[model samples]
Target: MTLTCIAVDDEPLALGLVSAFIEKTPFLKLVGRYSSAVEALQGLLTQTVDVIFLDIQMPDLTGLELARVLERSNRGAHTTRIIFTTAFDQFALDGFRVDALDYLLKPFNYEEFLRAASKARQYFELVHRPEPAPFVISPAPPQPVEAADDYLFLKAEYQLVRVAHQDILYIEGLKDYVKVYRQSDPAKPLLSLTSLKVLEEKLPPKRFMRVHRSFIVALDQIDAVTRNSVQIGATTIPVSDQYKDAFGQFISRWL
Candidate 1:
């Protein structure tokens, strides 16, 4: 499926380059192009875009501010994904905080732009994939018991893989799937076709905690806690205001 997108940048040259990149991409269709964040925000109100190639810095409104506005406006269901295109590398963390699909550093080549665009394409494909048919049950089998509860089985791709609870660093929820980051495999996370809420119910409360609407962290794996974020290995997960108090209490026990 082709993804409808928009390009927002104050720099004429930068905007032209991004728009061109989107045009050349096989699966991306450019729906709008704006020179400022304010103008882009207005365009978004009427446009049904699937992705946005946004610049982080602008005179009137920054990309981060506009991202927050979109986040609030699209609270539930699948919201438009963002791919931040900027010169600054420091805003990388802020980009993830707003759940951007990807980030492209300025002056990047077509290869880099295509790589980021591919991620957005994969995300939309997952979101729009057809549902599986219901299974018919046979006679009930005897339930096995007396096994250790440290590990659980999760369906990733087409296989059910066993995952240890302690090995999980954090879990990030996408539209209809959750990425399970594990200590054993830090580079690639296991993608499961399950909701965060369902996993939240299955995981032990003492070992895991929901820190944000889109994030759940393994309490034992958190290396450090900041005022509004948690550090786990190389990744920094934001703690939203909704769960701040509960997470703060979790920190208090260790302090």
Candidate 2:
């Protein structure tokens, strides 16, 4: 199966090189090329590709930041994976943290790029492999009912911990789990086996606002607001372009 892909880099030369590499790969199909992470994010809203050849460092939004957004949003059910291409070797850990398939350091040759592309192709094949039909099909489970506005229960460390809405400072999304930061406990956060999107649906929208794809901040706990980020206590959470207008309106209310 040919994998549809896109190349994103701020530098024209790097973008062109990656695009050319995609074209030469027999198993890969190049769909789009973006100069900035912001442009890539916008393009992704309408375009669905199998993989992304992403650059880690960019002006408005870094590749790591964009990967977090895609992970949280699940790219609207497309499940597009990332293969980071950058000059910085330091971002390798950060790239993997967001589940990047591979990290290609700058000045990489077509052979290196092909190896990464081959790995991606294998992954997609495994994911798309067909399973034998089961004779005894089980019924689907019911969805969880929304909790009360005052509090919610989250399963953490094998126990259902009761968390009050008023005590929460912010929620951070990490892949499939979330770290719920509380006002009472500043240093330690409760880790729950749930997505930020799941928690967002349960929380009262007026009391909490999702400022970033990876973060949902308590509206009342915001201490300060900057051009692209919000300060909650000593921690700063970014407000990405997708949610910037809503967050700006929230800021305008108090000003």
Candidate 3:
């Protein structure tokens, strides 16, 4: 079982450091991160939040103030455990007043975090009812499937290649051949035997999107776009009419 958590801090470095810690701990999956108390408030209101790592010294709304507000709200009455994160030792009492699961000081070691995480796990197991936490699909507990894990180990001519999830930029179809643009080397795109549509199902929808019948692009790598074409380095690929709706939502957010 995984403990879905979100980290909130006014500082970007603090957010990144906490995110790195969460990544190292596989049981804790990061749902989101916020740089302000206001933004965090909005997310909690809509998203089915389980754990929150809140910093106490934010600008507009102090962490204590935010905690006070959440504690009173009817939504917060449900089983969400908050782990207050802060730099000051003086405010430990304030955190306990709000029923914080654990208090973590900044610049904490992995072992310290693990201890805090263990406490969170205990609280979660004790409180949360046996029900799927809300998401669009409410995906069944991430199970391992051999078909889903399959990735081609390609060798073009003499050079050996290890094609993994992160190595791929996008896929392009040309008749029977599909080209996988290398993420590391943008200048080169590898030709492969796999069908573009078949490989599309293997990749996560959040990371990859079908922009055209003959093309799919990595959402992370897309830098610039026009109405018809999206730029990945020097290459400009067309956005077909078939995937216009999804492409439009992606564009509206980024643009």
Candidate 1 lDDT by residue in tens digits, 1-255: 899999999999999999999999989999999999999999887768899899998998999999999988954675788899999999976876677777888889999999888877876776687987655666898565444678877766333468999899999999888999999998999987789999999899989999999999999998999879999988899999999999889889878
| Clashing residue pairs, backbone N/CA/C < 3 A, model 3 | none
lDDT of 3 by residue, 50-122 (tens): 7788899999998888888888888745666677778898987667657677788887877987888877776
CA lDDT of 120 in candidate 3? 76
TM-score of each: 0.61, 0.53, 0.49
In model 2, what is the error at residue 113, expressed in angstroms?
0.4
Off by over 4 Å in 1: 75-78, 138-255
Residue-level lDDT tens digits of model 2 in 151-249:
987756333467999999999999988999998887999987789999999999999999889999999999999879999888989999999999889
Which is the leading candidate under TM-score?
1
- The lDDT for every candidate, in the order shown, is 0.88, 0.89, 0.77
Cα-based lDDT at residue 140, candidate 3: 72
Clashes of each: 0, 0, 0
Compute the lDDT of residue 129 as modeled in candidate 3.
49
